[model samples]
Target: MRKDSEHPFRQFENDPGRHALVELFVREHCGKIKDLLRDCVPLAKGSFGNILGIRGKAATALGLALKEYPRKYESVIAPFAEQQRLSVNIPSAPRIWGSDQADGKDYVIMDEIPGVNLWALPQLQELPRAARLRIFLDALGIVDQYRKAGKRHNDITPSNLGVDATGDMRSFDPDFMSDLHQSDTDRFENKSVGSPAYMAPEAVINLPAGRGPHSDSFSMGATLIAAITGEILPKLLGENGVNDYFFYMLNTEKMQREIDVMLHEIIKDPVLLKVLLRLLHTDPAQRTVEPELRSELESGAADHRTMRYILDDYSPAYRTAVQQWEERMGMAGEQEGFMRTWLRRTAISCEKLIEFFKGLRNV
Candidate 1:
């Protein structure tokens, strides 16, 4: 497949005709459309459509966010909106107020959830490690709920997530929410549905079997890494760029090494590092948020050891040994005997570390 320099949904923003159509629809449906549009602020622009924050009197009285899409997506957006409207209220998800079709456009009015996007939250990195981990675990729980309900957010990114005034995490932009039960023909295939930077490897490559809850887990893992490191997945993938990012994702060995290096740079807790690596496993079948792990995180019952403390108090010597062995192996020449000795030593130490981490999985 060729590089997708531009997602098809982006065209809606650039099409003069589509803009005119949205303007016409607002004029006909929203009384004093000019005044209302004047007060509306651009909140976000995603692959599927644009989200505008309703401000002034309309916003105060209605407390709604306006999301619009080209009429061509009516079949997809309409059903998804209606499903959200009827579903039992999911506390972490934005409520869909209603949907309408007119003038070659489909509009969804939803609750304008209060608070900043996850990425924009102030002092996020400065927060305690457990606090930061809680935020993401809560976010992951929201995704898990959607999965249990036979729905998939499809697009899970830091920008699409919010931390409400109550400190609860809420997922935004439901325009790409999809039903897992929907037939393949009705689904948005391939890379057309998600944010390129955070999409799952299978979704990025448009695999034949399609995506499921594990796909969301992969995105969540990437988001977790971003929250901790302040670097997006593309940046973590390095100079080879996004195309290589996708290629590396499909190659398990390379993906593991990349994730290990990135996480090790910022996260010192071995258990946390292992959990993240599992979530980001290249194979969808192997990627998951373990129930025990999720429960501990969500309940705030998990270990609250600080990153520095964890490194200092828990097996620092073993980690140091592993690091030194790796460095030596990297600098070693092609002497078979020298290489074999360090390789065996590194493998044994890594196994002990892995066992130590495994014992802490429940902690």
Candidate 2:
């Protein structure tokens, strides 16, 4: 969830003229929800819709869509939620309580995330560096999980991620979820998927392919950049002012310059910088080269020796990040073992990464 101030739908509730419309909408939906809900309490409104927390026996929250059945909730939203439950940060996906049509509006109730989003926290920089790094690792873990599953979380941002009481992370947005239903042609033809600030260059420039795991990696890297520098990535990259697609195409050189500056400024560790650059690469293929990476690995020519090379010169800061992350994950005294387990489970392939870097070098 975003900050209340940035929540545009909140204004409609406060505006004397627009307030009636919101109330009418909520009232009609509430009628349907109350029939199936107990101890319901109004939470807040967002641009997409409003949310409510269910007390008593439910011990959950509800999300009411402002729009009509945009996609098949049972197919798209429901399954996605179930799978996201397997995410590192989120313990379980919010269950779809039910959906109903009222006054031509549709509403659905899903379990509420019980934690504070990263953006809601004050003074993130003040948190221990290890703590901050853990956040990045957690986000990375989410991306890695989805990538291995050959799925994608189209939108990822601090505001869309939450930290529960157990210090685990969760994804809060449901609208942009994609099951990659489109064919190759449709994927290439899809438009921008989520927030622009964290979008990858391919998302801005290329149209033949839609945002994928690499784009997720780029957003994760941007989150890390924000964590380290305490500055939004777009601002740090001097990509602040203009967001239209044309501006990105017209200023390719300028964008590279911004990336160079950002890489130099926030990332002191060479290994981390290298990894981040690869993640944010302009060439979508170069970023991860999903097709190539997966294919080459399957061929077994490179022997899956990619990651070892990239981590050959591991940075101390990254070591610390890894150690801290492992410890927080309850592998405090088993770093090596935990890493092995993690590597096996992670969708990110070091061998594939090596191939990607090699291709970059050859180019």
Candidate 3:
């Protein structure tokens, strides 16, 4: 833990120990996101960057937020990453161990996902189908499961979805990302945790209200479409245009049809197509189905572990963050969509899972 990796601001200069603590603070409740990469992937010790901001204050804020929103956000992702767990074949996160630490601080030891960006893809046409399928299934299962559960990933793009030399595709950007509930006018690290181009219109235009599950659907849609066509998604968009010209590139009759029709046909599976369509709906309210398609996508591949919130107990921190959020830039309750309901439900389920594991007697 070098001090350079925190923000570059001078405020953190005096407390490398605190910065380490802040990172560890987030890491503790987050489990070993770092270890996940170390155990499953490869990495080089990259050069470090400068520290920034007040490490102590940031650590305090994280603690407060965790205490506040623990129940709402715990089950959804690892502390440092956005992730979940479902059936084994579905390829979700793994179940955590040694929870109920009284101190309730789990550290994320893993860094971002391990693999090259799909955007920087290498030749893989000759790769074995089994290898590719592993990546594809893992990503698809999680995407489908969470969407159906009413959660939306703000960023789903080729860059976020990693592909190794084997041509496997897994979402690196997910697991341990931001929580929807804690989002407000407050000041925390502002990452679009979701992707930019892959995000649905609702996700992009969010301000009066936040985006929902469909936003993730759109990202998946774009990613999947790119997978089929083998074209860069960003290349299709124009700087001056608002319309999603990317759909037209599908080169199908459905692409020329209405927006709804276009959405339905983007993928061959009728069940998944419908879920995707609902996720892409402009009106979040009209799109409230738990998007099974995306979840199916993510879970179909790998079963990841849930080590972050469960052992760390950071939900209360999230809840407390609401008070810290900036006054409604008028973003609250501005738009009620099916996604909102789904998100709430998803958060609740995550909480339940944590409680379930927590309630279990010690070994």
lDDT of each: 0.57, 0.47, 0.37
Q: Quantify how close model 1 is to the true structure by its C-alpha RMSD in Å.
A: 22.7
For candidate 2, the TM-score is 0.56
Worst 10 residues of 3 by lDDT: 46-55
Error of 3 at 76 (Å): 17
Q: Each model's TM-score? A: 0.65, 0.56, 0.39
Decoy 1 TM-score against native: 0.65
Q: Tell me the lDDT of candidate 3.
A: 0.37
Better of 1 and 3 by TM-score: 1
Which candidate gets the maximum lDDT versus the true structure?
A: 1
Tens digits of lDDT, candidate 1, 102-178 = 55666665655444565664334555556666675776677777777777777788887765433456677655677
* Best of the two (2, 3) by lDDT: 2
lDDT of 3 by residue, 1-363 (tens): 111122111122223332333333443444433322222312222111111111132222222111111233344333432232321122232211122211233322222222244444432222233333344454555576655544444556665565321123344434433444434122123333334455555544553344554455556656754554465344433222334543342332343235465444444555445544554455545444454554554444232122111111223332222222211112223223322332333212444444444544442
Best by TM-score: 1
Q: How close to the true structure is residue 93 of candidate 1, measured as C-alpha lDDT?
A: 71
- Residue range 261-328, candidate 2, lDDT tens digits: 77877676554465566666665555552443333323422111221122212233323433433333
Misplaced by over 4 Å in model 2 are 1-31, 34-39, 42-47, 56-97, 180-193, 227-230, 242-246, 249-254, 268-275, 285-363
Which of the two candidates, 1 or 2, achieves a greater lDDT against the reference? 1
All candidates in order of lDDT, best leading: 1, 2, 3
**Model 1 stretches with alpha carbons more than 4 Å out:** 1-39, 46-49, 55-59, 72-80, 86-88, 181-186, 189-191, 204-206, 295-363
The weakest ten consecutive residues by lDDT in model 2 span: 1-10
